[model samples]
Target: MSDRDPQPVERQLPTEEARDLLALVRDIAQREIAPKAAEEEDAGRFPREIFTLLSEAGLLGLPYDSEYGGGDQPYEVYLQVLEELAAARLTVGLGVSVHTLASYALATYGTKQQQVEHLPAMLGGGLLGAYCLSEPSSGSDAASLRTKAVRDAEGSWVIDGTKAWITHGGIADFYTVMARTGEDGPRGITAFLVPGDAPGLSGAAPEKKMGMKGSPTAQVHFDGVRVPDDRRIGEEGQGFSIALAALDSGRLGIAACAIGLAQAALDEAVRYATQRRQFGRAIADFQGLRFMLADMATQIEAGRALYLAAARLRDAGRPFAKQAAMAKLHCTDAAMKVTTDAVQILGGYGYTADFPAERYMREAKVLQIVEGTNQIQRMVIARHLAGPEGR
Candidate 1:
């Protein structure tokens, strides 16, 4: 049997680059975000000010090229920044992740002119973005999306559909939308850049969610909204591929968020264990509880390793869909398990809104559901193993 590389939590090579960014992100999150995360979540307020702080800190474009106002940072560095933010506030981390997803099409597939027109604002100008690929009838099975786009005589197109579960919904400055432009199938879809103020485009009231309440989530409706053909991200019938490619990269972001959330939960549990007294001793001294802590820490390390591996594959221009699926699956599941266990360690305190554990537990559930569900991730990995002939 071939030997496989062993994974470790803290890097042995000592990546100064990743460390520096992580330190900065941690500072910002602690100073500006951590204090308010709980309040915003409780009040159902959007942290747009925090978003501006991130953009101004040159963090909004961490994984993109510097030519377009981006940081030109590596995925390794970018992901850790996301992790730090998630540890502070899941809402902000998830909002950043979703914005990165919405911006992928322009960065990866748009014409040079298109990128020049939009990339700067998206990267460093505090402009939020939303990705619109899912419809009421076509969430998991996106190829069956019914949104239609028809080209007009004036070289414009009229798009009509309702996109569901759009993060940043009414708050975003622009949307990267996928609509059917041909016959029914994945190949029939096309991608477009629609401004938030475009005619006939509107968002519904934000969805009542289980957690991550500070980040807005709602349905966006396009009723005869028009855009110039020049706004298209790629050739007609290429939206499905673009959307899938975005997800391949976007999954890494979700994985990072999940790992961060898990790390926070683990930290809280460990701190609580050490402080809370038992029978004349700290609960952490108990062997059974210590083993639980060990398991939580181990799972967190595994989640981080999985996402970093996927990120390396992505940066190297390798086929990363399988790895991305694996990262998302493992990390989100780990987040759920770790957060739930944290609540158990916290005992009755974890169940109350006064603490963050219960909130983090609820937030972790959505991570498993989004970026393609954990079930979808399994299907993606299985397809890789089966190969084309297996189809």
Candidate 2:
């Protein structure tokens, strides 16, 4: 099984350029990312150099405008790239997704001057970014965050709070931070582009996690970290809106990554089944195992379709938040189920670190909880369906 390559996905790309882009991505994934994934992940080592390679290749900012160092690809193409990267390694794929999320507020809401000043360096200049919204006390209830950003006499904002579950945390070059600047609820929140090395900014130790340890998840502290007015991405009290918009796009990235991870697991399971002999026959000859593989593949395909549909809606500049939530929920759930089945198919070998199946299973679990928990996704979908819940 180790000697054979996994089959490439048959993608329906809109343009020849996109096909070329996918080919480039596949080559890089096969040559650079996939080979080192399991070992680096097992060692809990972040592949900062691979991200530099991606930045150089213009993969980091594919969905944003090309004028300011972005690739200008639509979400459809951008997400497929993410899926390919994720199939190679969740750490790299999810890192790219979080970086994109961190860049969204500035690209979408910042002034032309801001974009001209920072976007180029962020997008393709070997810089990494982190998104800061989830707080230690408020994960699901992000609107109820206690982080405070106060305007001082110097006209600079002094931020004071701790943001939890930040993907890049201490390692990021910049942070897109959402802090309370006014009232007690969502209305008071404001977004700021804070430099990672700003005075009083620090990160606690990375969380020891069930999976994806190679991607640092840490608590970022803002102890009176100050930023100039120019660093504010959008209007005060408009931060939550920016956050929601970014999350809608970010959820699609997660959905794509989930499908990619599922696809990888399915490929591994198939490869093992075809090679491993049992009862004087290959395991692939067993109907039960074949059915499991079929089910896993179907779910992955469905998830890919769902995420791409959401991406297309986004590319058309249409309303897609509900669809985004749905894709995230379904794809992540599919990832968990598919990874678990892959582990089951591998039998005892899947339970140990000797195989990638266990790692895939561990990684799939966190997807259901991030971006927004699956519970929050259901609520978001329900709100779109039944209107806002009676409070």
Candidate 3:
């Protein structure tokens, strides 16, 4: 509400416990993750060992209830951990975000039996998860998704269709799939938990993506894949709502990734400016370049504030869909701008893989596209403001 401090701020300064957690994560990130990121990404490799390290450190399940073997940490804490991970490597950050999104359906909608059966593996770190909501024909328009699941005489659900652009597609141990079960609308959709080894369930070869190369992306094909009715999440008509609700939280995760990427870019820029001298002085000493760094830092701080505010709202059980969408849109845009500027600050070296900024720039592009494009985020926010029946 004051000039120096903004209203609706999201993050609390790192608490003692949070600071300890951050230190632990940072140590692992810089020492363990940073060295391998570039090589793994270049080879399109997924780091199974790194995930094991994170799980052993109690990081894989940071935000869920503790009874399920999670850290039971706050989003505020969880997101900062994510930021550090991403600063080290975007692929890991994105994979964690996707896993968290996949967890939402089971945590929020599944029965107690289901939770007990699934959460331990997910929280304990043996199994990875994939979220299957988007299809070849439907990305932003989720309600128009074509995948279908029909009930059989044996009281099982038979699913047949392809899910496109699935993160962890071929690599995941399980998938959270949404399929149409009723009339042609979101209300007709239902969610199911499908194990990776299920018969007739398979994935296409991974997509050759522009960035986040270490993170596998592919199309999942469910050809008459069957599951018991108990596998369905929530009631028959609740999948769309569940997916959107999960996305409200997922958007914040992406926002954290953006902040981490931007911070990495800024750090590289600052380091480069100091080391790469111009006119017989460190370039950072130049007021023009200094101002640009100031702007980049300011934007990143603002993005952090926005996403954290929305996260606090969600944790407090308040209406946060609009705020989450706004955070996703603004923070991702700011990250894209900041990372690009980071490259510019590094001048020629920024364009090469020798430094991390070039990769950060490429990684930022996907943040804009995934978890609902910034364009779709704008529409979500606009709809929230304009009311259910818009003018």
Q: Which candidate, 1 or 3, would have the higher lDDT against the true structure? A: 1
Off by over 4 Å in 3: 1-15, 388-390
Worst ten-residue run, lDDT, model 2? 1-10
Task: Give lDDT tens digits, candidate 2, residues 15-38.
Answer: 999999999999999999999999
Model 2 quality (TM-score): 0.99
The lDDT values for all models are 0.89, 0.96, 0.87
Task: Compute the lDDT of residue 330 as modeled in candidate 2.
Answer: 99
List model 1 lDDT by residue over 117-222, tens digit each: 9999999988989999988888899899998999999989999989999999877899999999998899999999999999899999999999988888999999
Candidate 2 clashes between residue pairs 3 or more apart in a chain or in different chains: none
Q: Candidate 2, 12: how far from true, in Å? A: 1.2
lDDT preference between candidates 2 and 3, better one = 2
TM-scores, all models, native as reference: 0.95, 0.99, 0.95
On lDDT, the candidate that comes out on top is 2
Candidate 2, residue 349: lDDT: 94
